[model samples]
Target: MIDRDTVRHVARLSRLRLSDEEQETMREELSGILEHIEHIQSLDLDDVPITTHVVEVENVLGEDVPHEELSVEEALREAPEVAGGGFSVPRMG
Candidate 1:
């Protein structure tokens, strides 16, 4: 069971400002989630395989092939701003 104190502590750790009603709602919701997890833990699945995903997946990306490299002048031709033979971007604080 999720207690009010636990909920309050979690809210504090997450820097959340919750009203009294919200804290109570969170306690009930968290308790329900824990109950569901407990039910899942009680399931017997000795023959079930451990899998990250439920469905089979295959790589859909195209084959990697080497391509001709672009020249420095060609690369910088479309730049909005260029400096020192490279693209110049705005400075970030």
Candidate 2:
């Protein structure tokens, strides 16, 4: 069980300025959370497989298939800058 002193110490370590009422509330909540965790720890999980999610997810992706190729002119039709028969821009060092 989370005591008042433990709650105050935790709050101080976390740089929190909790009031007396808030500290009492936090103490009860933390104690409840620990109790729940203890109950969960007592459960039998040997038959359950560890998973990231409850539902099974798969990558339902389609096969990559190439289509008709685009010509240089068609490709550079809407380009802002054009160079020597290709897309051009600022020079890189």
Candidate 3:
């Protein structure tokens, strides 16, 4: 829970200018945020498994196919500039 003075102090540290009414409002809002965090902390999670992904996801089956490899000339044809059989760009200097 935050009081008006604490809110005002925080506002000063953050370079924020708030009216008296805004100070009171911020106090209430901060208090509510703390209360909500406390509520979340009250939950029991003893039996829950730690999961990195949200859903029960799996790699969908796909054909084991190989793609045709592109030749150097075919690959370099799309570049705006090329030199010495390689794609070229502007000099860093």
Cα lDDT tens digits for candidate 3, 18-88: 99999998899999989878876777988888788888889799778997789899999999999999989
Query: Residue 50 error for model 2, in Å?
Result: 14
The TM-score of predicted model 1 comes to 0.43
Q: Model 2, which residues run further than 4 Å from truth?
A: 40-93
lDDT of 1 by residue, 1-93 (tens): 989999999999998999999999999999998997887777889998888877889858966998778999999999999999999999985
- Residue pairs in collision within model 2: none
Give me the displacement of residue 48 in model 2, in angstroms: 16
Query: Per-residue lDDT tens digits of candidate 2, residues 22-46?
Result: 9999999999989978977888999
> What TM-score, over all chains together, does every model reach?
0.43, 0.43, 0.41
Cα error, residue 45 of model 1, in Å, equals 12
Clashes of each: 0, 0, 0
Predictions in order: lDDT:
0.93, 0.90, 0.89
Comparing candidate 2 with candidate 3, which one achieves the higher TM-score?
A: 2
Candidate 1 global lDDT: 0.93
Best by TM-score: 1
